[model samples]
Target: MSYSSHADEDDDVEIEEEYLGDYASVRSIVKEALPFQILATIGGAVAGFIFAGMTNELEMIPGLIVIAPAVLGMRGNISCTLGSRLGSAIHMGLITKIENNPELTNNIYGSLLLGLIMSIALGIIGHTMTVLLGFESAGILALTSIAVLAGVSSGIILSVIAVLLALGMFRFGFDPDNVVTPSIATIGDIVSMLMLFLSAKVVLML
Candidate 1:
């Protein structure tokens, strides 16, 4: 019995060591991801500049300035969550191929629903805040329209990008967790800003 116990302990130690060595350490993750993170940050900064350039037009819509940042941030949040989920699925071997699987469908639907709900909430909150601050603002209908349109459009695009990045990274033997979130965030910034601008234009015209 004592000998059996000792053998079990050795097996456990070997398994633990193997597991520890299989996973990435924090330093290694940071080193591998730093260059991509820097590039993504630069892309986000360019998006910010583009957003700044559109301030004149954005100013024309009352309370839109308040909604812009919230919408952009929410896009990143939603897309990052999606990316994380895909990365986990990839690591777990749940996603063998990028097809119309139930898991992928559910994730896409959930992200879209979350984006829509959050967009509407942000619209209402932005309108209320602008009113409280003694600023002129559009009605809830217009605000909601703009938010939903922009968020849904951007969500669709970002969802596809997130999935593709996860799959591509995994296929290339790179951990998706190390690259997907930052990449999605940067792309979300650019795409969300552009979508918001276009949505606002369309909403105002209608």
Candidate 2:
């Protein structure tokens, strides 16, 4: 009986080792994907079109008007990029979350905190630059506040979606390299534009 038990333990160890080896192979496969990088470029072009249309419709001063769309686009792009990176990292066991792994959780929190700070700074700079350039349609403080809020919210939301989608793909044995980045970026752009438009409309009403 003891001999049989020992054999069972050995089998379990071998199985675990095989699983680990397979995981490494999967990670390497994902890393080799270069074509996936084009998603960022594609996402950017799409964002440009959306922003142009939204801003043009507003009829605000071109200089002041451009700030909202430009910053929103940039924020959305950065958020999507971060989401892709983090999603990949999380899947490869490079990071873990509190609910999943304590270290990963801390890293996610830190990323979000930084996102908030960056959003505020970017918004303020965009509004200030326009104002300094003598474009007054987008009231500096109000527009800045809106930009900051939108950036932070968009960043956090996209990150969460990316992580969830990546995990789901992994569970289903799907290739995240082919699935995640563009989808998250495209979705993020849509949401970012909507947020910017809503905020601008609200500010104008105030």
Candidate 3:
């Protein structure tokens, strides 16, 4: 009985050590990721402020307010997905270095194509909703043009940023999964808002 008890005690100690080691590893990753997360969150807030400042312009178009959030949210969603996929590829050793590769090219094209299709759909939906709610709205063609142009412009920029950030974090020995999505989301918000505002201005002018 005494010998059995001693062996059980040794096993418990080993298990405890293993648990502690795993905890420490997770803590280290969180520590490494926290700063980048904080910065990205701050960037997101700034983007919100910019969006708020565009209220007057949005009011002029009546239904544009409906379109704005969809555009911004879509950009963030697409970019976030892109970041996650690239991070996974990095972890899997599929992206050994940051250069032109089939995986990267496919992801870029796919994301951009999706963005283009969704932008047109969102524009139509936004315009329909505005009319149904008895609000004046720009023509569907104009709205669709605005959404597609802004979306494509922002999408292109965000794709590059996501790829670079993921690769850069991996190169620095940090986990790309921990940093890429949040960072791209923040950047996506800012760029999408800016591009939307500019696109609206340009489209309305024409």
State the lDDT at 110 in candidate 1: 99
Model 2 bad stretches (over 4 Å): 1-57, 60-64, 94-100
Off by over 4 Å in 3: 1-24
For all candidates, the clash counts are 0, 3, 0
Global lDDT of each candidate: 0.88, 0.65, 0.88
- Tens digit of lDDT per residue, candidate 3, span 1-206? 69999999999999998867653477877887788889888998988898888877787777888898899999899989999999999888888765668888898899999999999999899889989999898868878888999999999999999989999988987778888988888888899999999998998788
Q: Per-residue lDDT for 1-206 in model 2, tens only?
A: 69999999999999998876665466755653444556656766776676676654367533436565565557655766666666677568775442566555654576577767776676677767776877664555776666766666776677677777766765677556556766676678766776676666666666
Q: Distance from true position, residue 8, model 3, in Å? A: 22
> Which of 1 and 2 is ahead in lDDT?
1
Q: In model 1, how large is the Cα lDDT of residue 34? A: 95
Clashing pairs in 1: none
Ranking by TM-score: 1, 3, 2
Greater-TM-score candidate between 1 and 2: 1
